[model samples]
Target chain A: MNRDTLAAREPLLLGAPAPVLAGGGAALALVLAAAAALLGRRELAAPGLEIVALVVLAVAGVAAVLLASPFRAPFTAGAHAAVLGLVLLAVVLDAAAQDGRNAVVADDWGPMVLPVFLLVLATLRPPREVLLGGVLAAAASSAAVAALSPEPLRGVAAVLTGVLPPAIAATALGATTLRALRRGGARAVTRSDAASVQEEAVARLEAEAIPLLAAVEDAGTITAAQAERARAIAAGLRAALVADLARGWLADAGFRVDDPDGYAERMTAAQRTALRTTVASLPLADFERPGLASVRGQDRDAVLELALPVAARPRRTRVAPLVPLLRSAFARADVRIGDEQVSVRVELTVPR
Target chain B: MSDAVWTPRFALSDGLRAAGLWYGGTALALALASAALVVGDLRAVAVLAVPVAVIAAGGLLLVLPLPRPVAVAAATVVMTAGATAALVVLARSAAPPASTAAFPLPPLKIAMLAFGVNAGRRRAPLIAGVAITAVTETAAGLVGPALGVPWAFDLPATAGLALVALASSGFLVGGRRTAVARRASRTAAEQDVLARTRAIARSRAAAVVHDTVLGDLAALAAIGAGPLPPAAAARVRSTLDLLASPGWADPAAPPDAVGGPVLAAIARAEDPDFSVRLDGELAALRGLDGAVEGALAAAIEQCLTNARIHAGVEGADVTVLADRDGLTVMVADAGAGFDPDAVDPDRLGLSTAVVARVEAVGGSVRVFARPGVGTTVLLAVPKAAGP
Candidate 1:
């Protein structure tokens, strides 16, 4: 399945709470525990204190699962905090469970803790600092648990079994995820930079081309070879524009079009054909004829009356066949026909 | 790859020293921990100590800046040996039968595989180091339980995690290098384009200043000194007026509009210096673009100006060549010559302006001057190739 579809399905399957909620619960629990210890007497019921801790831990676990859900924002400070809280709650419960205390342990903590850390490390945006801090905290906490337990040797063994591997794994995963992100970012920046340089080069070439063409035309003796060179320069400009258009089209399709040269030849041919067909249809008979006429005849013999349909309206049906012939003639000779003149002239056509 | 290089030797010495110190410390720690456990008869603690000693040693090896390939090989051997010894001892332990299960297959194999794979990578140091750590941890975790040893089984997961960390670090380093290279290349390209553009601009400016001002002044000076004729003074003044007016000087002015005045000025500049002749119809050339005409006229004037100033001897020749390709104005002096290279066009008053105007129309200037042989300045300009 595609990432978006998979992401959509994530929360439904997991029924996870949002990371922010879990983080809030954990923070509240910590504050309450500290307040209870300091404000209330030591004789206060241990069961009551344990019950509160369990509720807070459960809330934090739920928050962690929600934050880890595929639909959650990949990189956020709140998500990291929530994941960290989940791990801490797991550690506390694991310690409690080992002591045969039924009041606070959760069945899912063993399965959830490592995975939550992994999810946080993987999805967290800019995971470097937070991941490092989390790993360090976990390692230190494990060491503390080993050192402070009543059965020091067994406690150290428990810490090693429960804490070291998971923390190290989380650290490794976090570092890898951060590297992948950094590499991907670097690749994107490089590509954009290359594209910009190419664009600038094309712009410079275009700016130079216009003045150069003008100067060549002004010289009044442009060779066929020089004209071809000018056309090549124009082709380069057309290719650049086509590439830009294709990029926009591809971006809309959710893909980036990277290779301009790959599609250039086809685009150029299509554009050239379109331009040729458009130019071929334009009438040019008026330009062929001069504004003034000069005729030399010896004494106008017999006063010949020639009624050459000067104002006859051309048949529109003749336009299609006549256009090609007219284009050919105009190509060889300078044609300056106006629209009004074409309308009033004799119609010319050829069979299809 | 070259044996002659200084870098390779330096890297080798540094790596060897670091590896020796790390390994020695690890061996000493292991010896001390073993002695403590044996004396106290703490079998459980002894099992833990062995793995801990091995791990500490491995970590120390990685922390040092040893060559990656060498480190990977060393780590693989050390981990394999440590695992074997822990397995043998754990099998004979007093733990229950279930606790003494055989080591899992894949995880142990993967650890060994990682060692070889990591050592083969291009960035060997980072890849191998992480791989060794990962494999060793995995092997320890799986093998420890089977032998009834207390070795930690978290290493495989830890190694996998380390792989991720190392990969990210590599990316950051590679990204920085790529950015630096890209910037350097861009800077070089920009500098090249700028240099070419500046050279073109400087040449054009020199030509324009010479044609309009210095040429007129020199002709007037000649006529005032009375070399030959009285009619020359009138011609000089008319030429001066055309030069002073905006009509001829401004690029936007019409060619035919300034034609009459320019032709009069040219006549004045030419008549007093030599017996002059004008060929080619001025009216026929009038239909051309104004900028083209102006460039052509200015180039011609500069050539004449050069002939008068530097020719030094009598009867210098002035030729105006024009075609569809553009115009060429040649001024040849039958006078004592000077080196063209040695003569700074700016100081000579004619060379700089003549070269600039000709090149402004995508043309060139050739100065052939030698002592006792006289000089020839040929300026060829194309009409369509403009500034």
Candidate 2:
């Protein structure tokens, strides 16, 4: 349903175990034969080699199963080549066994080989799928050998011994792979949840910080003690914001419980830039117009506008929304310029 | 009273001690296991026996009070040594006959080198532990045959190989866990600091609001109950205007004009002749705020009040000067001045309140006077990073 769940499910459903099982079998045979030769029992080496060739053929069967897996783009032609090599080796081994150099050739081997080939073709060539396919192939081959062998009971025992270990291992491998995928999916969900919480916290902090700052501005004449308190408060707010930002950044980046200084620094820079641009874009009234210019000269209005660009901006546009809040914060104040004076208005802007 | 009580025994110190003990016990167990292996009884019983005894001892130690770092270090060292020895034995046993002469070097030396480097670097000890485990496994593969161990290094021996693989995987998992734990701890600490800071800021903002706006509003309400005297009403009006002024928001305006009305209102409380001078272009003092103006006005008024009360002066001269660099205000009186050194900043009167007020706005105030000579107060205010 979720991205992570999909990631987990897709991998498991599409994973083919046949390749891994067949490859593992081939590798085991090769390694055993190589070891037998290296150990210097020359006469017994041929049977080992024949086994190696058969294992290679089994590997090709596994490859075919792997190709059947969903999303088999990653498994290339080289994998197919490896499977073909296995078939060639199996043929060579069968020929050598017939020559009686040193081969353990069972009479009803064709039926055993056919099931392996069919099993390989049924599953796609993903390692997990291939492993599963190999197990099935081994099972089928063992059953066929038991049914067709002259000593049916002995054949059954032999087949069971030969196929059971690999089958159990293949199944175990598939289970482990599936478990890992599920765990990964769960972890991804947890991370996303954490990230969402962090983001919500950050947004809350930002919303809180702006109002707090505005309140500080509204607080009438600050004493030395009050200023110190304000400084402390500012520092505290900054720290809180930093923490929230760090958490959010880490969560978004999928950093579970890790130091996010590097990420936070980058995010803070971007936030600061956004804040600055917002501030700069805010429409502030410009009131520095020359006092007598509008009355004194024909071009005086333009001159006044040029001189006090900020003051010349329409007051309507520069309307302060937080004026009432600020008014409640400070005492009434007056100034005397000659005999006539106007009142000072304080306004605060609450950042959203 | 309960909050003030200092109970030392129930503190974080005990927890730290417990942590240490736990680590120490773990170290001792690891050491014993390694020692047992080094003594070389290659029995399955020995493999199971030594580790179990060590773990039990470690678990017991954990309950005892001890320093955490010491316990952890000790445990880490012991585990490292034990793990290293195990790998060494495994590697030696697994070596091919032809490669047996170089047996110990490949597995044992590599593990030792990794452990030593990691210890020196003071990185994740768990990673070192895993390397040691891997090396020991390799060694076991080489030497197991010579030692006549039942397990042989050969194909079709999936059970034996799987066990080794599982151990190696465990090592990797342990390393990752350690890394994650360390990272989590650091993030938590940093987050705590940040949370504390934010709380402090919020408290400060609340305090500031209480002192400024709330105080002013209360004063306004009190004055509004009755018809204010004519002079007082004018002063109140001016004060209200100043409070509402846009210039108060500017961070670079002169203190006097910025909040002049508020102080003028306060001065009107006692003296009807109280007045403010705005000598320079008001536009030039663009960044002044309400607080700085209030402080400046209060300081001048305080000086005047002091002169009238202490020096028997009739009136004081107040002059405000604004320039590109800064603003200066001189409040001089014909009243007699006292010794500057005699004034304590903590004193209740003008020296403490007025001088402090001026300074709070990034300004300096100086009083000069002699016996029978008028005292003059010179105040200089700067306009930067202040209200």
Candidate 3:
């Protein structure tokens, strides 16, 4: 159920597939138009308009790719408008380039190709937005032909045949798809959460202690080794519980820092584990003052600084092994052994 | 164990339906476009375009993500406009019959299909067919005398479209029903597993308490009327420390030995005051289910305690038998025994503690006892089936 819903798979839907569909549709439309122009070059009265229309459509195609890019954020209404507007302009230009030739309307790729772009638009935005844009584009292109052509009735009829049906069909199909996704997302099963935390803890403890108890039972008496192992396990279990009860390991480890916003929660389990291990590896005397830590905001990043006393003079080799681990956890990890103090600084990308 | 393992019932169907819609809708649109192109009379094609454009615009209204009532009303207005345009075109003496007949079919049917798909946003596609039938019938009636040429409504074709709509809706509904049932059954299974797990954990926790804190208390009682011995005092202090420690519930390393649960139960029940002797194939309990082991251990401990307290016996014998069907455990004692039927059902001894605990793990319990004859409790549990 985690990735079953449309909302969960939104990234996948918008990722490679969106761009492929949009780019592919735009490319095919452009290719067909270019091929038609070449095949009917002699029939084209205003070749200048045709050349300008092709260039305009090429721009729209590029814009479509950009809008559909998975790397970019969800496109806005303004971006949708701008791209569709460009396509519409090129369409009118393509029609005008036919020089009022009624027989050539079906051959004009503008109306024929417009629906493909509309379908591409459907991929990036909501169904309602795409439908609105498609309708406006269809109406304007159809009206332009009806007004500019010498044979107004044939012009309108041709534009209707090429544009309206496909555009309407695409809208119906796109809307159905979008509506299904929305309904699916709404009904997706909820995932297990903190409700299982207690069970998990109890199960972990049972797993550890059951064998020792069984061994003791088999021998009919507790050995010194077994007693010692039991005591050690108890101590370890105690430490873990204390850390959990106190909210985190940092406080129990004797480190001090002010994080009122609780940004540390954003760190994954691996990152937190690395930080705990790295700090635990260092000697208490190495710090400027034992168990002291500091945090400062540096623009968009949070900088955590741990200072070591100059007299401690921890060797470079002592810190070298830990740099990679800290670096892996954070984007920037700096360990400087200056004359005044040996300090470690880590830069964390502050979550919005 | 992860939520990713399960998939909802309708997850695939919704997508397939969408794909079908696109394929069907696109094919219809293309066919209409092709027909318009094939026709030679440009003058008639122009007149035919009116109804087609009107229908296309009306059909597109179904694509809007609007409330059901609003969409229906909007579609009505646009569809009515389209019918009016169709009427005007049919009435014209110059309009060709071929162009007029083909013009309204594609766009009107697509609109009808769209309505079927988007009806009430989630209604069955049959609703769209029903609504389209009414509209088409009305249009045919109004245009029946188009310049003395009676226009006919195609009922069979409309019925076919309705059947298509009904089939699509049935597929969606059937898939949704199957998914819901699957999800419910899986959820129930998961909850049952979780309950068994929780029971096992509780049993383990109880065993630990008996081993440590209760053992220390017994040791203290044994050293009566004097200052506690060094070892005993140390043990008491360690128990206190453990009780007060924050990580008391921390995860422990898993036990290495199999059959540990049963062995541990026998050991915990083997008190100086109450001895327990184990016999039979104890090794057979190895690799058994944790729940079965925990339940058996808890039940055996209770039985031993009962023999010591009520039966006035110093020791008991435990026998374990294992075969293909399952494992059976019997704890017998020879001493003063009371009739099991005479015991109150509410008593938290043999009935609640032993019987309920064993039965919880898909096992059964049989208690045999009579006054002065001693008592024997038999517990049978099935093997742990492979995952």
Candidate 4:
């Protein structure tokens, strides 16, 4: 699994469908507008045309609400397109009702409503998909106007110039920004060394083990005390070996924890790395309380807490960039900037 | 191991903010330019400038770290009111029909798109879009006749800009999703590496103990407390040498470079009545990491002991299998079996001796048995630590 998959899964699996937000808003607006037209507050050339337009707008509002509902499977691109199509059809009907009242175009509502709907719909898709949808919508609307207007070319020009720029520009701008960020993030990823981790693990144990063993070899024979010492060393070695087997990057990086059950070991690689980097970024002198990092496991959930120094407490700007990675790695993360210290608490759920 | 975690380079929300600013600013500029050309009177331009300035202030809010829905709503309302007021001023100034036809509608549509795209949550963008669209359309319909502009609203322009906003928002969401997936996969791969590296470390540590501490203790036990014998001294010196060697810690060094702990355990576990019929991929055991070897050896011995002491059987079967991932050992005994779960929690036989040992090397233990059925213990160990 990837970071995107993990993060996306939370929202995609649990959150309301993407289109629902736009659909609700659209329904409210359409309903109000339909009510106004029915109340004779707005003028339509024909009474029948006015009713038909209102009915179409009401249908569009209902369609938007239906689109917002959860599907058994993924809500596909076709579904989004269909909903957008219905809204556009409402726009066409509304415009047609106002056709005779205007000199050149039907009314401003047709021009304004479609783009707003498209803008909301675009949020549900990718840049490319949005581009295709935008282009298609613009082209279809232009064609419809051109077919109806005496000045067909002028009508098409109007649509292409006035309707299309905002969506296209948004796609271009967003895509550019994302690419730049990805490029920078790639460099950060490249800096981690895997082999050094092994070296670090080996070094941690070698310090205590080598001196004791060498003294035994040099003594040549075991005295009552030496034999006793050897037995003690053996026991220590066994305990250390078992403990070391369960050790993770947290202990390796010098974070203190009362983790007798080795709950720290259950942390995913991303969590370890992110915590390591974030801790490294904080100046040691700024630490509010030394060795304040800990992981407490309750059932399958592990809650990790770290205390940032008093000096770092006010520097939220510096910590902001690091927060996203931490949040992404853990199931839930809260960073509280307090007067005494900056406290970061993260919770993650491990598999049984 | 490749990297601790994969992180998105940039935030999608920030990108949307930038886009909002760009689109909003662009629309404002266009509106200002159109008002300048249409209303030649400097006084009319100055009058239009008041609302334009307010719209600019509203656009600034989009980039601020304020609540997104609130910011977008505030900005959209400001733009709508400002644009409407400016159009009204143009109408009073008697701006030409063609100049009045387009004046603020297209630019306002773009500005509205900007607000909607930056709204940050569901329905807000649509609501912002619809609200702005309604105001602009209403303003245009009322102001168009006053100015005698043939077409007050640009329908195609509105539709086009709406599609653009939709596409942009979609792009942002897609980027965010991609970043999340990348981070998750990296996390998974890193976990795999962590486990393998742990197993490898466990193996190395076991080797160190097997050769140094275990050997020294055994020798001391056998010789008693005394001055060293020449042979014993040499053995002690050799153990010291082994501990001091940097190669012992090097992952590339074969774990069996010193001694095969798994073989030793097998030899120690065996007796005449409780023979182990060792079979299948025996050669693969030679390549086992020291941790895996030590754990497997101890666990196997414990299983055999359990079989001999408990099972009313003559012999047991031991099968070792190797695959791309690692090794799997099946120790089966046709004897008196008991429910694994019902086994005393304090009994070190299965939990500590077998389960703990196997798990230490990033391996798993599965004990399958029933009252009348045979017991089978399956131990699986990975070859290396990571993805």
Cα RMSD, each candidate: 25.2, 26.9, 20.5, 17.3
Per residue, candidate 4 scores C-alpha lDDT tens digits across B198-217 of 44444554665566657766
Query: Which stretches of model 1 miss by more than 4 angstroms?
Result: A1-65, A68-71, A100-112, A115-153, A160-352, B1-78, B88-387
Angstrom error at residue A59, model 4: 5.7
C-alpha lDDT (0 to 100) for residue B329 of candidate 1 = 57
Per-model TM-score versus the true fold: 0.30, 0.25, 0.41, 0.45
lDDT of each candidate versus the true structure = 0.38, 0.37, 0.56, 0.58
Candidate of highest DockQ: 4
The sequence of per-residue lDDT tens digits that candidate 1 reaches over residues A1-352 is 1111111112111111123223433343344333333332332334454455456555665665465432333324565666566556544544443343222111112222433344334323332444454455445445544443444443333333333333334334334433333333221111112223323433444464434434443443344554455455545654553443233211222222232222211112112222222222333333222122111223211111111112333333223222222222121111223334432111111110
Which residue pairs does candidate 3 place in steric collision? A207-B254, A208-B252, A208-B253, A238-B247, A241-B247, A242-B246, A242-B247
Q: Against the true structure, whose lDDT is highest?
A: 4
- Residues B1-387 of candidate 1 have per-residue lDDT tens digits of 335523212332232233223223423343334323322436744664575456345545543457865666676667556545544444555432122112221122222332332243235544554555555555656775655555542332333233333333433332232232223323433332332222222211212223322333333333332232334334434444443333232211111111443343354455444433332222223333565556656756665555556566645555555554555556677677777667755435554566666567677888888878987777665645665
State the RMSD for candidate 4.
17.3
lDDT for each residue of candidate 2 in B1-387, tens digit (9 for 90 to 100): 246532211221222223223223322333334323332444632553453343334333323445544543444444444433443344444221222222111222222222221221123333433444444445545554455443333222222232223223322332232342223323433443343233222322332223343343334334433333454334434534443343232211111222335334333434534333223222223345667666766776676667666666656666656654466777776766666667544325666777788787788887787767877788776754254
lDDT for position B336 in model 3: 84
After TM-score superposition, the amount by which residue A102's alpha carbon in candidate 2 deviates from its true location, in angstroms, is: 6.7
lDDT of 3 by residue, B1-387 (tens): 145532332433344345334533553455345445544545655665666566556655665667656766566567656655654554452543332223334334544454445444235445655666566656655664554545554422343353334334433443342342233334433443343333233333434454565565345334434444567656655655554444332212111112566767666676657766555544356547877788888888888778877888888888877755678899999988777767855336887789888888888899888899999989887765222
